[model samples]
Target chain A: MTEVLRVHEPGLFTTIQDTGRLHAIASGVPPGGAMDRFAHSAANLIVGNDRSAATLECTLTGPGLLIEAPCLVAVTGADFDLRVNGAPAPAWIAISLRAGDELAFAGRRSGARAYLAVAGGVLGDRWLGSMSTNVMAARGGMHGRPLATGDVIAAGQSAMAAVTGRGLARQLRPRYDEHTLHLVAGPHISRLGADARAALFSSAFVVSPDSNRMGYRLEGPGLETSGEELLSFGLVAGALQLPSSGQPILLMADHQTAGGYPVVATVVSASMAVAAQLAPGDEVRFAETSIETALQMRAVQREALESLTS
Target chain B: MPPQRSTVKVRIHPLGDTALLAELGTRLDTAVNTRSIALASALKKRRDVRQAVAGAASVTVQFDPDQVTHVALAAAIRRLASKRPPMEEPGRLHRIPVVYDGPDLQAVASALGLSQQKVVEIHSRPIYRAFLIGFVPGWAYLGPLPDELVLPRRPDPRRQVPAGSVAIAGHQTGIYPLNSPGGWHLIGRTSVRLFLPDSDPPSLFRAGDRVKFFPIAE
Candidate 1:
C-alpha cells in the first residue's frame, strides 16, 4: 500500500529539502536547503528515512493532510498544534496513521521552521543533491516555491511497516537567545573603529521584516569603517556583513556568492541552525568563540546524531 | 583589539576566529594583495592553522585551539609579517568571455563618463586576479578593474541576473552562474561556463588566478 498525503491548504512557506548543495556556492549558487537542518535530520531518522532524503520543511502554518494507507510519521522543530482526523496529534513523537486518516498542522508556537517526515521520503526529482527550493532563483523544491492547495504528495510504500518500539520526542531547544549571535571576526574586521566593532557584540539587534532565507537584515547599531569602499571578497553562511548604512546583515543559506560590504564577523556553523529559526521581531545578540570551540561543538553534534543510528 | 604595528602604518584588528582586517594607508595595487597572500600562506603552515585568506590589507586565519591559543596565533602572525618575502607565481591566469549587452550596460558606461564601446574595451582589457571565493559558491571576485571603468552597483538590484552574466562593480568584475539577484552593472555575457556542478574543478576561476575578459556579441 502506498502512503500519500493530499494537501488541502499549503502553509506560508512549505518546500521539500534535503541536506542542500554545498559545493554549488563557489559557483554563485546559494546553499538552498533546510532552514533547521538538525530538526530535518532528526525527523528523517524517526521515520526510518535516510537523513539526506527529501522531507517537507513547513513554516508557521501548513496544509491539512489526508493520509492514505498506514504510515508512521513524526513532526519536529516548531511546536505547532498538530491533529490527526480532528484528534490532537503529538509533536516530536512518531505516530501511526491508518489509511484515510487526516493530519493537520496549525500556526507557530515557538520556533519558525518545522519538519514533517515519513518512513520513506517524499518522491521528487533531484536538483543538485536536494529537493530544496531556492525561491529567489525559482529553482528546485516543489517547483521551487511554497506548496499551495491541492498538492498531492506521494509517500513511499511500506513506509510504516517498521513501526515497533516507541521512543521519547526530542524538544526544540536552543542554547542561546536568538537576539544575539556569536561570531568569529572576518577578514575585514579591522577596518571598523573599535567603538563600532564593539557595538557588534555588545548591542542587541532586531531581525527586520525584510529577512528571509537569502539573508537577515538586522536593524540596530551601525559600523563605521575607515574606508568607504572595500574590495569584494569571499563570504560564508555565518558571515555578519555590514552594508553602507552600517547595519549588520547576517548572510544565510541562500546568500549571494560574493559581496563588497565589510564583514565584521562570521557566526560559527555549530550555532547556525539555531540562528535559522529567528523570525522577524525576534531579537539577537552576538557572542565570540574560538575556532577550536566552534569545531568541537560541531563534532559533538555530529557524534550525537551518529549515535542515533548506531 | 587593534594591533600596533611598528613596521607599517595600517591599523589592523582580529576578526573573530578566522581573519584579520586592516585599513589600507594607500590604495592597494596587485603588489600589495600579493604580499598579503604570501603572509597568509605562511600563517597557514602553522600546525594550528586550518585556513588563511588575505584581503587587500588584512588576513584571516583559521587555527586549531588544541595546538595554539589565540594570543599565540597573533604573535606568530606578527612575527611572520615582519619577515615576509616577495610572492612568486601566487596563482594561475584565466581569460573569460563576455557578451556585452546586458540590461544595465548603457547606464554603467554612462556612469563612468565613457562611450559604450569604450566601456567594453576598458573592461575587457585588464588581466584581473581572483581575490577570494565568498558570498556564494563558484562566485569569483576578480579585482583591480581599471579605475576609470569602475562603477557602483545598482541602487536596486535586478530581480534576477541569468547564469553566465558577466558584470563589473566597484573595482571588481565577475560572472554569475546559476541565476541570482545582483546589482552589478551587466556589461556582457560569457560562453565559457564559470560554474559547473558536475565538472571536476566546478569553478573555472580560483583565488589567485589571473583573468582577462573578451567581449562577444549578445
Candidate 2:
C-alpha cells in the first residue's frame, strides 16, 4: 500500500531537503538544503533509504506528524525528545509506525536542527534535479514552501522492506557542543589588517537573532579592512564575509551565489555541519587550519560514515 | 568599442574544499567579464566540475573533492584561463514593455536634472547586456547604463518595492522580479514576469543575454 504523512503541527520551520540543488548557482540560486547534512544522510541510511533521499529538515522544534500507512522512519541530528503515541521513542534508529500512529517532539535538548527520514522518501517535484526547497526562491519540495499543518505528503515506493531495530552506534552519532569552529584563510584575507585578522581568532562571536538560512550575522569584535570596495565575486557556502559594517556574516546553505563583501576565511568542510547546529545566542570562536588539514579531516569523517552501512 | 583584447590575467583561488574561484579582474570591465564567462563555459564541460557560477569579475567552480582533488581542479581552471575562448554570442533579445509611471519617476528626473520624458527615452534607448543575476532569483543585473542615467542608490531603501519595478543604481539597471525591499531609484514599472517558478528555466533572463525596454502608455 502507498504511504503518506499528514502534518498536524508544522513546528517552527520544517521543509523537505535532499543533498541539495547543484549547478543552479550560475543563475543566482542558492544551494538550499539540509543544514546538518551529516545527520540527514545518517537518518536516511538508518531507514534503508538512499543517503540523498528527501527528508524533513526540522528547525528548532519538530512537526507533529500522523502516519497514514505503516512505514519505517528515523530521526537524527538535534537531541529532540521523540514520542510515538505518547510513548518514549528512541532517535538514531529505525522505528515502525502503524496506520494512524502519531509522531511528535516533546522538547529540544541539544543542537538547533534535526532530520526525519522515512524508508520511502517524500516524493516531491524536483527543481534543477533536487527535491530540496529554496524558500527564498519559492521553489522545490512540498509546494515550494515550508510544511504547514494539514499538509499531506506522498511517499515514494520503498526500495527495501521496512526494517526496525537498526540503530546507529553511539560512537557514530555527532556530538553537540560549544567549541571553536575551524577555519581556512580565504582569498580576500590579505585585504584585512593584521590586527583585524588577530581579532577574528582572539574573540568569540555571538550568533545574532538576525541569523537565518542564508547566513549567521555575528556580533563581536569588528574586523577592520583597507577600506577598499571589492568587486562582486562568487561565494561559497561557508564563506566568512565582512561587510562595511565590520561585523562578519558566515554564509550557509542558502547563501547568495555572489557577494561584494570581502571574505576573511571559510569554515572547514568537516565542521560546516557542526556550524549549522548553532542557534541564536550561541557563542562561537574560530581557529585557523591549513587546507591540507581540512581535506584530511573531511576524508576521515567520510570514511567513518562509510563504515556505518558496511 | 575598441577591438577585443586577449591575454587577460585570471587568478584562481581555493574557496573551501568544494569550490575554486577565478578572479578575472578587480573592476567591472567588459574584457574581464567576457573572460570570466568564457572560462565558466569551458569548465562546465569537464566531468569533475559540478557548477561554474559567473559573477561580475569572477567565476566560481564547484566540484566534488572526492572525485577530483583541489589541486587537479585548480590546474584545469588555470589551463582554461590561459587559453580563454572568445565571448559567446548574446542570447535572444528580450523586449520588456514598461509604463513610465513609477512613484519615484519625478524624484529620479529631478535628481538627474532631466525631464521625465527624456529620462524614459534615455533609459529605453540602449540594448543593455545582462551581466549577472544575484540578490534574488530571476533578477538579472542589466547594465552599463548611459552616463546621464547613472545615479546613486537611495539613502534609505524602501520597506517594500513592488514586483516589476524597473530601477537603477550606480551602473546597473534591473527589474524587481519579486516583492522585495530595495534601495535602487525606481524609474518605471513593467508588466513582464521576470520569474515563474513552474516555467522551464524559470528566470526570463540569463547572464550574457540582451535586454531592451520600451515605453508603454498606462
Candidate 3:
C-alpha cells in the first residue's frame, strides 16, 4: 500500500474525476466527465493507468501536499508551476517522490484546469462507473466534495512504481488556446433571428466569471428570437442556449439534462475539449461548420484514442 | 386570436453523420407533443438508431450511418409512422412537495402579477408531463403550465440555482436536480431528491412521467 498524502491547502476548486458518466444521457444524466477529457487521459498514460482512471482535477491552483511515502506521479494539462518539497520539479516530467516529500502546484497559466495523475489511479468510490465527482449532483469521488485541507489521499498500490518513464509523462501535454470554437447550428437555429445567428458565428465572446463545468456564460451580443416561449426540450453538450436577453451560454460537461431556451448552435465535441481549457477573462469567437466536418473531427479523435489503448 | 397549432408537427431531415434535423410546425401543446414523443420512442427503438430526441415540435433521430443509411432509416421511420398506434401506456403520476422560496421566487411572482401563494396554486393545478430531459442530469422538463403562469425567464440567469429548485419559464415548470445556471423563473424548492446516483433508478421522473407540484409553506 502506498502512503497517504495529506493536503495542507486544497486550492480554489479541486475534485476527483475520471472519464465522466457515459451512455446516461437518455436517462437525463449528462456525461459529467473530466472537463479536459483528453488531458485527463494523457495524465493516466504517464502513470500506466487506463485513460479513465480517477485523478485530481485542480482548478486555477492546487493543494500543498504532505507525501508520506514514495510514489510515481505526473502532471498534465495546463502549465501550472509545481514544486516538490520546495524544490523545482520539471513540468510535464514524471518524477518519483521519496518518503516525506511535499508537492505544491501554483495557479494556472495557459489552461483553466490541470490534472495530476498517479500510478494505479486515485482510490475513490465509483458512481456510474466513474470517480468523477459531480459536486453538483453530490455523487462520486472523495465523498462528493472538493478536497480540503487535512484531506487524506492514498495511491492505489506500490505497483504504480513499476511504470517509470519521464519521456512518456512529457508527451501527454494538451494543446490549448484562447481562440474561437466551432459549432454547428442546433435544432432551434431558426428560433434565432437571422442577424443574431450571423452575429453568433461572426462575433467574439468573452467567458464570463459565472462559468464552471456546467457551462460557460458568454458575454457578447444577446440573441433575440422572434418567438420566445417554446416547450422545454432536449439538449446536447456544447448547446449554445440563448435566453430572452440574447447572450449565449455554452453548455459543458455537467450541463442539465434538458432546457427550453433557443439553441444558437452546438459546439462540436472535439472542439469542446479545447473549450474546457478556457478560463475567466479569456476571449473566444465562434465559427460555423458543417455537421459532416464536425463528425469527421470527432471520428479522428476517437480513432486516435483507440490507437493509444490498442 | 386562435392558438397556433402548427408548432408541433414532427418533420425529419438528415444532417448526416448520424444526426437528423427535425422541424416541429409551431405551437407546442400536449396532444401534438405526445405524438412527437411516441414517434421519438419508436424511432429510437431501432438498433441502428443512436439517439431519437424531440425539440418543440420535431424529433431528430441520430443513427449509425455505417449500419443503416439515412434513406433506409427514413423509409423505416415512415413505415413505422404509418402503423403508429396511440399511446397505450399513460405516464405515471408523481406529486412532489416544494418550498415556495427561492432567490428568484418573489421576482417571478411579481412578474406574473400574482401572490406567491396564488402562483403556487396555479403551478400545482396542472398535471404536467415530462417533455424531455437534456440540459442537466435529473432535470425533468414538465410543461403546458397554466396560461396565467406563463412568464418570461429572468433577463439574467442566476449563476447557480440550487438543486430541487422548482422553476418556470414561459409555459413550462421544472425542478432543477443539480445546482446549475438557469433562466427559468423560480417559484419554489424541493428536497425530495430528484436524482440519486446510487439508486437503481437514478432519476425520480422519466420522460413521460406525470408531475404536479405540492406546495409546502416556507
| Residues A19-74 of candidate 2: C-alpha lDDT, one tens digit per residue | 88766666667778788888888888888888889999999988999999888999
Model 2 chain A poorest ten-residue lDDT run: A170-179
Stretches off by above 4 angstroms in model 1 are A1-3, A154-172, A175-180, A185-187, A192-194, A289-307, B1-117, B126-139, B151-166, B175-181, B186-218
Identify the leading candidate in terms of lDDT: 2
Question: DockQ for each of the predicted structures, in order?
Answer: 0.27, 0.62, 0.36
Which digits, one per residue and each the tens of the lDDT, describe model 1 over residues A1-310?
A: 2537777778888888777875455345666778777777777776777888778888756768787667788887776888888878786567888878888886577667778887778755456666777775455767777787887777665433465333333423344244455577766778878898788778888889899888889988777876777655435567888887888888877776556687778887667777887878788888877767776776665665555465
The deviation in Å at residue B42 for candidate 3 is 5.3
In order of appearance, the predictions have TM-scores of: 0.74, 0.94, 0.79
lDDT of 3 by residue, B1-218 (tens): 54333333345554424456555445756665666677777877788887776655556676666577666777776655555346447789998888888777687778778887788788888899887766666777788888888877678779888888888887678888878787787778888888777774577777777998787776
| TM (chain A) per model | 0.91, 0.96, 0.89
Calculate model 2's interface RMSD in Å.
1.5
Each prediction's RMSD over C-alphas, in Å, is 6.2, 2.4, 5.5
Q: Rank candidates, lDDT, best first.
A: 2, 3, 1
Least accurate stretch of 10 residues (summed lDDT) in model 1 chain A? A164-173
In Å, residue B178's CA in model 3 sits off its true spot by 7.0
